[model samples]
Target: MEKNDKFPTRKDMTYWIIILILFMVGSFTVYYGSNKDMVSHIGFGGTIVSILLAVIAIIYSFYQSSTYESTTYKLDTSAQKIEEATKQLSDVSEIKTVLESFKGEVKEINESIIDLKGISNNIGNGVNSMKESFENTKTTFFESFNPISPKHVEVDEIDFSTNYFIKMLDNGGNFPLFTLALANQAHINKISKVNLRQYNKIYMKFLMGGKQADLGKDIHEAFRNIQFGMLSAYKSSRFVDIDFVEDDFIQINDINENLSQAIVHKVESLNDEQDGDKPLYDFLLTMKNKLSWDEE
Candidate 1:
């Protein structure tokens, strides 16, 4: 058994014992007084006094005993209830403290989650902005120069560096100008065969295709006009073509030496120019005109 249940309170037991002792003492006193023979001369008065005293003693003893027992029992029960209530109150206090701490932690975590969501949204928007910039730059470059190979096919990725150089020149990105110049030194090479007749012919055909909104003339006359334009455009230049059955180091060197210098000079001039602040949609519209379809 628990220690609390085993030990009864001493006050309750002592109160009952005192009431019992009082009853015994009162009973003995009344009996002895009533039986005394010497009180015969005062006969009736003595008997009446004795009987009254005895009755009084009995009533007082019974009342005291009942009161002590009832009071003690009630006090003991009340004290036990009070102790239980105190313990329950303590438990409730501890639970409330823990709950408050947990609530604070939860609030902090919720704030962090909100912050992370905001950061994620910002990053997503940044990536989209970069993608748009790249696309716009790409469209601008393709519009200015359409690169077709000698066979009239698009150049492969192996020539991407050369293509990048040409596009940057058209759009005024000046950084690569010096490098292109160095690559074009003629003393470094000679005896090279220069060949670009087919590409020139195609460019001429495209320019005088009679698709101009305002220009109106005979179709064959347009072709004649294009021939004259080409002569004037390249009047100071001369070109000769020679095919090599095998790899020729001298020819390759000559080709690079002749073409790289002039292109680099022209590219550097364009690079010094500034980029226009035109809206992207407007730029897109202009670039799209070079293609066959509409801007949509």
Candidate 2:
């Protein structure tokens, strides 16, 4: 009812009918006038040949249609495969992009770790330096308060008379007549007990108070002259009496005690005043402590 679009139109059908009628009439006339005689000569063989050619033309048309259909199907399948391969390539590219991003992140994290390690090393070094400084400060602080111990020497090896005699001569003191008498060993041996007692009394007094600065210069010089004479006499006599010289004078304990008492008196006199001799006083106290002298 919709005019059946696949069929030929009325005008085309009418045209084709007229052309068919004309072809049939023309063909009949040509066959009757010319081919009728020829057909009588050739008989049915010519008619059979025409029918075989028509059958071959129909078979060739069918083969061409089938080949066209197969080629179209193959082309469609190839296009589908190409589309799928393109999609897979796109997915691989995306994966590569993700991996590159991840690698960059990992590199950043490694760099941060290295930076942290450097900071940690710096902090460790600072702490160690602080500890060393503290230890040095502590050592210096303790040493400031602690006193150093002194070295002791043997007293018996020292020649007290000779040492005193040299100090006296160096001070420009004069020798006495008793020293000249004692220079002769025979006169020294012949010295009487009464004379020895008087000599001992004078020498003991000189040793006890001779070195005092409070004594007048004349008295000090007189005491030094007498000390020089007495020391020269003792040395020339060659007396090895430890009590007379070495133990009484040159022993560190006896000398430290005597010097300590003198320093104490000097320090007391400088109380509430400028202490010019404070260093000397401290030195004597240290020496006395080292000698283990009893404090007076």
TM-scores of the candidates in the order shown: 0.30, 0.28
- Model 2 clash pairs? none
Query: Which run of 10 residues does model 1 get worst, by summed lDDT?
Result: 173-182
Per-residue lDDT of 1-296 in model 1, one digit per residue for the tens? Answer: 66655444787689888999999889866876676664554677888989999999999999999999999999999999999999999989988998999899899999999987876575455435433533553344334333442322244534534444354444522212221222232223342332222222322232323121221233223323332332222222221122232321112233232235444445344434364322322322232232212112
Provide the overall lDDT of each model, using Cα atoms, as 2-decimal numbers.
0.43, 0.43
The runs of at least 3 residues in candidate 1 whose Cα sits more than 4 Å from the true structure, single-residue gaps closed, are 1-38, 41-48, 126-296
What's the CA error at residue 271 for candidate 1, in Å? 32
Task: For residue 22, give model 2's deviation from the true position in Å.
Answer: 20
Residue 221's lDDT in candidate 2:
44
Model 2 error, position 42 (Å): 9.3
Model 2: lDDT of residue 168:
27
